[model samples]
Every structure is written in structure tokens, then in C-alpha cells.
Target: MNIFDNDSEVLQIGALTIENGTDSVILSGDVEITKTQAGKAQAQALLDFAQALCAVFDELDSQGLPATADKDPSKVVMVNNPFE
Candidate 1:
């Protein structure tokens, strides 16, 4: 399941819990992979999660908005409309 989907707010894969927020994304839980087949699958899922985050970062970069941009809404200053 795509955790980035609009309908998905919380997604749990293996021992990882991902929470999608309005202004942030939260990740909780520990990922411990053993040497068994289940461990391999868990490792793959972790990799996929990392790749997905990378893709989201890339998309944000393409939009001229870096992920590290200041997110303080209170610090935002409204400017006068130039078209007015």
C-alpha cells in the first residue's frame, strides 16, 4: 500500500509505523531484521520506504522547495499583491 496516498494517514509495515501529518511526517518503531526469510522481506520493505522518501524529496526539490526550508508558519509575512 502507498503510504503517501491522500487516504492514508497511518501505515504500519512490519515494525515500522509511519504517520503522515499536515506539515510533517513521523516515523516510529524499530526495524530489526533477522537472518530468516521474514528478515529479508523486512529489509526490502525498509529499502522501499527509504526510496519512497527519496522520491518525495526529489519532487519537492523539483518544485523549488527544499525539504529543509523553514516551516514556521508564524514567521511567514504576507506581502501586498503586485497585481492590485
Candidate 2:
């Protein structure tokens, strides 16, 4: 099953543990893929995980809050609270 398909705080697939945080999603653990059928399955799982992440980015872009590759922390601007 696709772990990102639910609202659970934590989800697991094989050897990976995905933690839903307040501002980020944490991924931990290791998945080993050997030269066997089982290994191919594991590789597919990894690809699914990556595709899920891309979906998230696409959703964000659709909402006009696109994710950027900017790595400079100084470029961050604090704006007035919109809820106030």
C-alpha cells in the first residue's frame, strides 16, 4: 500500500518509517535491494515513495505556494500574519 494515502501520524513500508511532523515529513530506515525478484519489488517501492513526494510538490504549486530550490536562509522574509 502507498503509505502517503492515509492521515496516520506514522507509516511504514518494508524497512522504512515515515513520520509526519508539523512542518516536515521524516523518512528513516534502510531498504535493501538485491539481484532478486524481492529486490525488484523493493526498488519499486522506493520509486513509489519518490512519486508521492512529487505529487505533494505539484499540489503545492497548484495552490501558488510552489517549493523552491533556494538554499539561502537569509532570503527568507517574514510577512505580517494573514490570520490576524
Best by TM-score: 1
lDDT at residue 54 of model 1 (Cα atoms)? 83
In candidate 1, the residue pairs with backbone N, CA or C atoms under 3 Å apart (3 or more residues apart, or in different chains) clash, namely none
Q: What is the per-residue lDDT of model 1 for residues 2-78, given as tens digits with 9 covering 90 to 100? A: 44455457767677788876456788997788999999988887788788878886876788865474779999899
Query: In model 1, how large is the Cα lDDT of residue 8?
Result: 53
Model 2 Cα lDDT, one tens digit per residue, 39-84? 8987787788778878876776788863554467898899999899
RMSD of each: 9.3, 8.5
Model 1: residues with Cα > 4 Å off, grouped in runs: 1-7, 67-84
Q: List the residue pairs that clash in candidate 2.
A: none
TM-score of every prediction relative to native: 0.66, 0.57
| Residue 58 Cα positional deviation in candidate 2, in Å, after optimal superposition | 0.9
> Which whole-number lDDT from 0 to 100 does residue 47 have in model 1?
85
- Count clashing residue pairs in model 2: 0
Query: What's the lDDT for residue 56 in model 1?
Result: 80
